[model samples]
Each structure stands twice: as C-alpha cells, then as structure tokens.
Target: MIRVFGMHNIQPLLNKVYPKATTANGVYIYDEYGKAYLDGSSGAVTCSLGHSHPRLIPYIKQQLDKLQFVYRSQFGSEEAEQLATRLFEHSPERIYAHSFFVNSGTEAIETAMKTAVQYWQEKGFPSKQQFITRWKSYHGITVGALSLSGHPLRRQRFESTLEKYPRLKADLENDTLEKLTEEFVQVIESIGANHIAAFVAEPIVGAAGTALTPQAGYYQEMKKVCEHYQILFITDEVMTGLGRTGTWFGIEHWNTTADIVAIGKSLGAGYAPIAATLMTDEILEPIKNGSGLIMSGHTYSGHPLSCATANRVLEIIEEEQLLDNVNTQGEYIKQQLNVLKENYPVIQHVRGKGLMLGVEFDPARKGFQQKLIERCFQNGLLVYPSVGGPEGKDENGILVSPPFIISRSEADELLAKLDQSLNEINQ
Candidate 1:
C-alpha cells in the first residue's frame, strides 16, 4: 500500500493501493474491472448532484470555448459574479454579502479564519486572534483549519505543532445546552474577548457524525453570547450547505446566522473545484472602507471555468427544484433508518437531517463497522465509515448520503442493499 501526505501529512490513499481508473454517474461508481457499486455516501457527501451530470459537460465546454481562465485579483468575470449572486440568494443576506472563492473546502475554512482575524484587526481589535472550535468536528485538513478542528485522531500527531492557538474542547455529549453555552463562553472569556476573534462550528456536525444537531436553542444562545462579546460567528457549512439539510443553510434550522459562512462540496455539484467564504457587509466594511483589499489571493481564486461550471450547477439545482426533492427524500430516508434502528440490536442510533444520515453501531459489538463495510462492499454498495474512532472496534458509524438526484426507485434500491448488508452483519 502506498501512503502520501495529504493536506499536512495526513495519510491519504495512495495510487498503488487505491488504483485510479473509474467511471461514475448519478449514484453508481465502477472500477476498471466494470464492477459497479452504489455510492451510498456520495463520496464523502460530495457528488450531491451525482457524478458526471449530463449538463455539466456542455457548460464546461461552453466556458472553455469562451474563456477558461482569468485572474480575479484585478479583474471580474461574469461567471464568478453570477455564481456569487446566486449563492447569496440562497443564504441569509446578512451572512453573505461578499464572498471569496477558493479551490476546496479546507481552503474556504482557512480563508474564513483569516478573514475573521483580519476583520477584527481592521475594527481596531487586533488582539482578537484566537478561535474556538468544538470537539469531534472536522473542519478540513489545512493547518489553519486543522487547528480549529477537534477530531482526535486527525489532530493527535499535529497537536505539538499547533500549540500557538489555545484549544478548548466544547462538550458535545454530556453538557446541557446552557452548560455547553457557558463552557464555550467561559473559554472565550478566559482568553479575553479582545483576543478571541471567532467561534467556528458546523450547524449540523457532518463529518463527525450525521446531524449531531445541537441541543434546543443551543446555537441561538451561542449567537447571543458571541454578539455580547463582539466575537464573530463562523459556521463551517462545507457538508451541510446547499440544501443538504432541507434548507439553503443548516444554521437556518436554529433561526440563527453566522458572521461568516464557509460553503463547499455541494456548491459545484462535483462539476468543479469551488469553495467560498462568505461574510456580511459588517465583516467586510472595514476592509472595504480602509485598504479596499483582502490580504488573501490564490492563483485560481475565482477560476472562470470553475465558476461557469458551478453557475450551471446552481441553475440546474433551481430549475430541477432539487431542494424540494432533498426535503422529501431526506424525510423518507430518515424514517427508513429509524425503522432499521428499531429492528436491529446492533443499530444504536439513527441521526442526521435531510440527506446526510448516520447509523451508529453498538460499541460493545467489536469489529461491527468493518463487518458492515465489508458486507456492503461485497453487495456492491459504497459507504464511508466515520473518521477518528477506536481502531478495529465498532466505535464509530457509517454515513449514507446519496446524491440529491436520486429517485424513489434509487432510494428503494439503496434501502434494500442496506437491509441485506445489515442482515449479513447480524448473522
């Protein structure tokens, strides 16, 4: 097996072990051998519109015929502007007046953090630099984003290197809503409000586990606390945005908004590498009014080709009314998963919102997760196990997020395969 450093020395699947040549469409992936597997998890909750959508190719071709690349530093392109405008239409106007495009989710997160710090500095609170993130969260693999992530296994080796930023673990399980809010507030207070730039979190914790939705009124309370201390609220919606949770933004479920919103994964609908960090006018005012420049720039910051592709995706999503499909199908999947939980002794929990679903196994059932994955694979299904759990143990769960384009028949097929896989595990 080959191992290579991915996003800060994290061991990613190497070419030797995970050989390339593949074909995929909708919710099915095929290897070079022509063995097809149902993409149960949508390739880590990406491919939301499914792989190789017919419309994306023509859109990309059209952009290529016109202009493939343009420097967004000094110039503005119609594609980029149009995509930004569409994104804002879906999100809260107060949360996303200005956007900075990047290549991936981690890049978006890193940009959000830096933007928060810069906004504070521009507001004459240069001391506000530290950030607070919750435990068991996956923000991405970039160093800056990793510093804000709380996934234990992902950060175990990098802790020594990330000591500059103070880390505070918010209780995700034990603490009551008020207690958790107070704990988070105390952490910021201890670091001094003037020194804490932002508090970042996933409104519906995606990678850690499907829709680990916060306690009642938790986020609303947290927002109030941040407002009181003048701290920026940054919501990492890489997996939960784009109508994944029955809403344009998952934070809407709590009736709250963030100062900055990091969105990706589904934005391009697997057609392009595009991610963005959105901020309110308040957050961008200082920089716009002062230097009129953001300190960050990337070679492909707003690549025209990517923007064009993403814009087409946005159009398709709207024209197809996929958000309605997401809500309807998401509710169906949740109900079915709940039925499974009731039937299986090993199934401990069924959680998530919209299409993002998780099925946690009993911790006492050793090797259950691996057994489940192997069974699913043998049955021509593809699913992703939760990251950062006890090795060789059933300490984690599995994600079951298919594309929004999936139909009723496809959903039935997935459920049948899942039932068979679960039965095999029970035996």
Candidate 2:
C-alpha cells in the first residue's frame, strides 16, 4: 500500500512508522493498539481544550447543521458577527476595531502584512511597503508569512522566493528599554520609516521555544518608536493569543497595545481551521475614507462554521475559567520542570508564562532533545522538539504548552512522565 505524506518533511515519513491515532480525550491520545500518549504540547499548541471538548462539540455540530459556509463578500452571518464581538469584548477597548477572519494562522499573518502595506497606501504612502521582523521567529508557512519569519531552517528552502526583510536579533536579555528603543530607531533610520510598513514579532516567541520573552518596558519602548515613525506594530500571536500565555493576548503582559494582531491556534481550539487579523481604527479609517474596501480575502475567509466553532471555543474558555487554571497549573508545571532541571544538568533553562513553557537543553549535548522526545514517545508521552535560532541547528529544547484546562494532578502526571523520560534518556 502506498501512503501519501504531508507537510515539508516528506522524506522522513518514508522510513518512520507513525502511530495510528484511534481516539483522543482530554489530555491523552490513544493509538490503534490502545497505547495512550499524554498530550504534553497540545498538538502544536492548537488543542487548547484538549481532545473532544464536550461544550465545543455541540456548538460546532449545531453550526454545521444551520450553515456550514458563507461567502464573506456576498453575505455575513450572525455567527461571524458574534465571533467578532467576542474577540472585541476580550481585547482592550477602543484598540481593535475590526476583525478579518481567515482559515489559518498563516492566512491571518499574510492578511496583516497586506493590511499594513495597504493601510499606508490608503494613507497616501505607497512606498511604505517594507517590513521589519526578528531573527529566530516563526510566523507561518505561506510565502508572505515565510518572508516575515526569521527562522533559518524553515526559510532556507524558500530563500529564493522569500523577501529579505530587515531582521533584528531577539535578545531577551542584555536588552534594556533604551537598547530596545534604539534598535527600533536604528531600523527606522536605516530604512527610513516612511518606507517601512510594519514591525512584526511574536509576543512570546513560540516555535522558537516558548519563553523567549522581552524585558520589562521593551515592547512599550518599541511601540513608542513605531508610533513616532508611523510604522504599524503587528504582534503575531498565533500561538500566544486567546489565553495561551496566561492572558487573552500575550502583548497584554507588557501592558502595551498593538496596531495589528494575528491570532490563531487556540482561536478555533483545533475544532476548526480558523484565524483572524485584528486592527485598530487608526489603520482602518484611512482605507475606509479612501477606497472603503479591503482587497485581501480567501474563499474560506469568515466561514460561518469556523466562526461559530471559534466563538464557542472562546465562550468555553471564559465559562470554564481555564485561564485561572492556566495560571495556577502553569506555575506548578514550571516548578516541576525546574526541579527536573536541577536533577539533570543537561536541562539548562526553563522559561515560559502560563502553560506555554520551553525547556532548553545545553547544546553541547548534541541530539539530546530529539533523543528525549523519541524516548518520551516510547514511554507514552508526547512533546514538541524546538529549534532555538539560526545557531539552533545544534541547540535542543522542547515546548511544554499543555491545554489551559490541565489540572494540578494532570500537570503532576505530565511532570512524572517527563521525569521518567528524562531519566531514561540520561541513562
């Protein structure tokens, strides 16, 4: 039997035997052999409610029965409107005035990129189309999104087609507010802010390992600089938004506002493929006054079924008070991870907020992270291997972002399995 593979790593599938997932519930996925694997990273951090969330299923089914899809340009659905209202309700007031829905995080990011450029064009600055992003960041897989991502390995294959946006190093440490501001000013001075459309970054660098966070007042200073030069500050929150990082939005941790934000992953909670790009009135007004139309959209953009599913996901997050669980259990998990770190010298750093955590190993232990993940899978635990940066070819790590509803006992079980895996790998 010939089997078709998926994604960029097609070669690996040829020789590797993968588990056939028969069922999943809560924080566990079961194979055809009935071997259960604990979902440590929540399926690339998309299953925010874990598997088969009870509340989400019914709403999705109802929406499916009522209306599965709708063309956004021809018609608008109440489901889509409610989703927008819910998003606005959770976001800071008067900041995000519009929401453009798309089917995936990459689409949302691509939308934000186009929105930023077109916003300037609508404001009579056609030359302001250049973007500035950081090194070691992962935006998405599409051409525009790939152009914005600074991950060397991911962009390597597409170097010929990707735009060479001016990049900055994301120095979480050694970056004071002054230095952060200076970096933005330098970029603006180098490119001329009038020629720059946006400055994009993740709130907490995900995929690059979760806790590559900024220093205190860093984002505030950066935002100030962007505002001074009229460059839109676009926060890519695909993995950090919708309560993934202990808050509704990761940028909220810094107490700063973004001109544009891309949201996904937990937005649909793996129930549907959906994402949205949110923007403030300041960026939207000029376009509304000028062209009064947005040129970017997809066929599945604002799909009613997807919007309804996402709205319910948000409602469930609030109703279940999962954010509180995230805070409480996130701290507990980090504590456990730190304890594991002390016992294993290979484990160098444990960093993250809420449930989104990163455990970076000392790179000197070559191939240690991959081996750990393999060993953990055999031991019935699943984790995501993380590559740190351009120099991350040798660096090893894992992202431990679990669902927000993870309980203290479940967190403990996760830690226990991780401890056992680490011990086994160490031996």
Candidate 3:
C-alpha cells in the first residue's frame, strides 16, 4: 500500500504539505477536504478545457477502447495522421506541414532542436549547429532544450553541463525593433551564421518574462534576418498554441510564420500527454529525401490513445468556438486586471493575449509575490508564478490564465476571488 500523505514519493514542494486534489470540474479543483480552488492559472497555463470536461472524458474512453498504444515504427494510426493534419491546418499559412509527435513540451523542444540540426545536416551544412535565443525566454527543461533557453534560475544548478548557445540580451519590453533585430545580426556576425542551427523564441515570452510582448514588427525583422543569414527560425509555441491565444498559433497575431514550431500544453489541453515538432515542407523534404528519416523519436512518439484524445480535444475547441470566447473573456479579464493594477500599487505590469494573461508585481517588495500567492490560495484561487523584474530573475510574476471554456459568471467569481486575495495581501 502507498503512503497517502507526508514524505511521499511525489513531492512538488518538498518542504511544504501541498494540497491533494480530490476532484475537479470546469474551472474549480476540489481539495481532499472539499474546498474548491478556482483554477485561475489553468494548471500551469495548460488545461485549456478545464478539469474533467464532460465531452472529453467520453471521447477518451472511446479511444481507449479502440487502441491504447502503438510504437511509431511498427504501425501508423489514423489518430496521429488527423492530429498532424489538424496542427498543420491551424498553423500560420499552413507552412508547418509536418508534425513529429512527442509526449511533452520538453520532448517537443528537444526534438525541435534535433530537427533543426538534422535539416541543416541533410542540406549539406552540418556546421549550422549553434542556435540564437533571447535572454528573457524559456524553451523547456531538458538539457538539450535548456541549452537554448536563457532563463537564469532554471539553468543555475546545471550551468556547467549546458551548451553555450548565443543568448541575445536585448529587452523585449523597452528595446526598439531595430535594436533588437541588430542584436541578432551582431550575434550572428560574431558567431558566424554558418555555424548556427536556428534562432528560437517564444512569440509572447511566458514564465521567464511574465507575458512580455515585443514590438509589432519584431518577428518580421527577425524572420528577415534568419532568411538573410540562412538560419531557421523556430517558435516555441508550447504555451501559446491551440486556442489559448485567440489565434490558433501565437505567431499568426504578427502576420508571420516560423520554419519550425514546437507546440505542447494546450495541444493536449489537460486531456492527454501529447506534443509535436512542426515544420514546413522545405524543412522536411530534404531530410525525408536524404536521410529517409527524421533521426529523432521516442517509444511513445505516436501513442494512438494519446493522439486520439488530443484530436478530440482540438475538435471540441473548434466545435465550441472557444477561440471567440478566449477573446471575449480575455478582454474582460484583462480590463479588470488593469483596474486591479490601478488600485494595487504593487502590480507593475499586466500583459498578455487572449486567455493567457500575466501580472507582475514590484519585485523590490520583499516576499510580495509569495504573500499574494498565499493569500490567493487561502481565498480558494490558484495562480502560476513567473519570473519578472529588470533582470528577469525575480519570482514577482503570476500568470492569470483561466480555462477558455470559462463563462461570464465564472469569470466574475474568479476576479472577485483575486480581488479579495489582493486585498488580503494589502493588509
């Protein structure tokens, strides 16, 4: 028998007695004692459909009945093919025509890195193996994925083992597009573009940057630079993909596209463990023709049950027109957040798109974010912590992302709980 409580095998916070979730539905998670905590952050900015969606449960059961698992090499399932097609259809310009499935966002990012290198290698340019990324961004947690990320706290302990990928230190919030673009050019010149594999970035910096958005023409200029330097442009859309950003793909908001995209989080939408590396025909054709394979995959790369569940998740989003709801509730909540910012002097920033909003408090206030988070938790609200401050190293940010399926009344209740939490923090 397994121990039910203290000193357990699964400890997210080793020092604290974390609440054990007993049940959940819609935007609320019930603790073991029957207290309901509103899922304001959508469970780490995933879980777009919220907990135990009625439609999703039945569909998943149906898939489990038909097929549970299948190794990618031995057999191909209709689920995988349709999921790939759905991702491609949702991507910008339909350029990302190929999808390589994986189990999580970390795996997706790692696979994307390998795919970028393999694309260049297949095209007879093996030296293009280095990558360029921003200082205020996070790709994933794996070693290879972390190598390309510039998040400081996450890389501190494992600093000696990670790769020295060129990380551009320009500020996304205050820097001009020209300056930001020039920094990339200078880095490419300094490192030599021929030696760089790709340039990876989050469309709207999350977790590491507190929903930091760049100038309007930021990606357009960066994409132009990549085109000129013969480097692939990869977008880490793990958080902003699917219907989270109102648009299917976050980059679509900029009227641009990427050569490669690594998407997770909302793709599975709390229904299944699924993610994928998506690329264009140009990127895939050479590798398909030369190596006859992508040269990277896992045992559960295309697990049939996971794929089917994810496929149904995407379809429900489509059928329900949740994208429109994202814009509607997102605007309302963001407006209310701004109102909160006005009343609370601690809130330094309120920024994000659609349902994926973030609020940054004054990092100078000692233990401010922690206090606010605790107060919110006590008030039956759950939000996600993020990094903020001038250096992007402080834990002063909180993501206010709620489920897309949230209705107007639920939205009000969420905001009321948040307001109460902030009031308590003020006390």
Candidate 4:
C-alpha cells in the first residue's frame, strides 16, 4: 500500500485517487493500470520534450556517470559553464551575461529579486529596496516571489507574511498604451521611484488564466519607465521561456530587454530540477566592482546532473527545430480554440501566445471551470486550472501548454478531447 498528500486538499488522511505513473512517452503519461493520459499541460508546462526521450536518456546517463552533484561555492562543473555559454548564444546581444542556476522557479525568483537589490546597493542606492509587480501575474511560490505575485488564492493565507509591493492593475478592457504607461508611472511615483529596486512581471501572465497578455506596446512603455527611473526590469519566464512561446523567450515577442530574467519549468524539461536567473552586465558590473561577490548561494545551485540535462534539452530543441513546430502547431491550436469559442458561449475568450494558450469560461457559469477540468480528465486529457484571479480571487479558466514537440495528430487529439469534455460539461 502507498499513501500521498494532496497538493491543496485540507484532509491529509483523505484518499486521493492519483494514478500511479509508471511510464511516459511522446506526449502521454501512463499509469500502473496502463491508462494513458494525454499530457496536454506538459506536466504543468515543464516537459518540453514530452517523455522518455531517446536522446535525453543517453545524455543524462553520460553526465551521471561523470558527475551528478557539485556545490557551487567549492566546485565548478563543465555542464554548468557550457549551459551558461549556450544561454548567452540564445540571449539578446549585450543584454544578459551572468547566469545564476538554482533548483526551482521560486529560487530563481528569489535570486532575481536579491540580485536587483544588490545591483542598486552596489550602485550607491541602498535605499532602493522596494519592488513593483503586476496584479494577475505569478513569479513563484516563495514568500518573496509571492509578494511580487498577485494571484489571489495563493497569497490570501500568507498576506500578512508577504512583503508589501505596489501592484499595477492593467485594464484589459479599456487599455491604451499611453494610459497604461501613465498608470505604471503613477504607481512608481506613489511608491517613490528612488525607493524601488525592480519592476517584475510575466511577459505573458500564466497561472492566473487568459495567459493574460498585455496590450500592444505595453511592455515597451513599461520598460521605458524602468529605464528612466533606473529601476531594474525583470521578466518572469518560468512557464513561457525556451520554445514554449514560439520564441527563445517570451520577452522576445515584445522586442524588449529585461535586466533580469528568471527562467525555469522547462529548463530541465521535467527531467531534473533546475532554474536560473539571467542578469545583464548593468546589474552585475556594479556588484562586480563593489563587493565582488553575489550574496546568494544554494546547495544545489548549478547541480551538475541538472545542468547536463538542461544542456541536452536545449540541444534537442535547437537541433530538432522545435521553435518552428511551436509556431505552426500553436497557430492551429489557437484556430481550433477560436472555433470552440465561437461555437460555445461558455468559452468567453481565448488568449496567450504559441503553446502557452488559455480558454476562459464565462464567469457567470457556475462551477463551469471545475466541471470542465474533471470532464477533461475523464476524456483522458490533463489541462491546468487557472485557479486564482486578480486580488486573491477565484477565476474560472483552463491553461493549455502542451510540449513544443506535440505533433499535428497529437494537437488534434488534444483538441478533440477538449471539445468532447466541453460538450459533456455543457450537456
């Protein structure tokens, strides 16, 4: 007999009917009962290469044979160094130089925040300790990250414990680049720009539903403010980085540069735990000239096995032209979702870029999101629920971010499953 704790259930003793995952292969996870679940969510948008990848296994084994772990403070690994070089090759020119590897997205977020603060301190602005983040955005789950996040349900219980930060609420309904820019500037002014260290956001908001994209020129306008105020701009790409968004990074869509980018989820492609904070020379040079050391360090920072796995993951993505696949398949998926939205009144909207798409249910439809989630599971597709909304409230929606390698047939199957599930829920 085996037991496990539920992710958010109140009863620890309650029996959760989680299927025992025995194996996974090519966009599907199979249980001990041999029931296959289409990995429509890519295991929370983490598995970029599907599962049981033929090439990844060999690379992982080779790295494991050579080295599995190394404390960053005392040792260095070729895998980590090589991965950093590869990241720069894919990065925007002169925008980012240093990479700080960590174990998860939350750690990456923490590191980015700390790095932002350190940058300001080293530049003779130690009082620039405050942060500004957007509402309806998620950075991570740690207290610091949560403080920067506006996801309602995730932060309600720990509201008192989280750090206080100015939250900008963008009105999607009446948004104009000029108005949004003014709003951003007002928030900074109210917070006292001199006291702020950074402005952080997900280039494409995840976890809060709608993948909540901003208006055109929105990020550029915000970046302008950050640049003028000497505040570091941070883009949290934990879910939309790599090839998931049809580009190397979500920020690329806007052609905007970030001072710090906290990336993870697909960094190790669900094979191993790894995340990293990529910082610009502007953020690092000041620190380099001052203390000559980064204050943050983790035991598993740049773990050799994880870095080796990520390097191979990047290699596979580049070699296989997965970015092109994400572009083509993502457009087809969006077209299908738009058709579904047109056919069903329950689907209020469809949003997001590339594979990181979302379908929001009518808020007026009671229990619709939950019913759809359960129905999708019964139909053998697993999608993520967009649980919380702005200001710690529950929102009704589903996020669909399958692996970048999902084929046309797999994409069709995913759409079919969703359509069937939605039809059942409607009936």
| lDDT (Cα, 0-100) at 114 in candidate 2 | 92
Q: Which stretches of candidate 3 lie over 4 Å from their true place?
A: 1-6
Give lDDT: candidate 1, residue 100: 92
- Residue-level lDDT of model 4, residues 1-427, one tens digit each, is 5655545555433565566789999899988888889999998889989999998998898888899887898899899999998897888664678899999999999999999898888888999999998778888888889999888878889999999899888774357888888888899888788899999988887896468787778788889989898888999999988888899999989888899999999999999999999988778888999999999979999999999999999999999999999999999999999999988988877988889998887777878888888889878899988843444256688899899889999999999999999888898
> What is the C-alpha lDDT profile of model 3 across 307-334, one tens digit per residue?
9988988999999999999999999999
- Pairwise lDDT winner, candidates 3 and 4: 3
By summed lDDT, the worst window of 10 consecutive residues in model 3 runs over 3-12
Query: Could you say which candidate leads in lDDT?
Result: 3
- TM-score, each model? 0.92, 0.96, 0.98, 0.96
lDDT of 2 by residue, 1-427 (tens): 6655543355445767677799999999999999999898999888999999987888787777899887888999999999998898899654787899998999999999999989999988999999998876889999899999877778888899999899886466556677667777887898998899999999898786446777778888888888889889999999999999899999999999899999999999888999999998888899899999987999999999999999999999999999999899998999989999999998888888998999989888888888899988998888887776335454488999888878878888889999998998899
**Clashes per candidate, residues 3 or more apart or on different chains:** 0, 0, 1, 1
- lDDT value, residue 325 of candidate 2: 91
lDDT of 3: 0.91
**Which stretch of 10 consecutive residues in model 4 shows the poorest summed lDDT?**
4-13
True-structure RMSD, every candidate: 3.6, 2.2, 1.4, 2.4
Which one wins on TM-score? 3
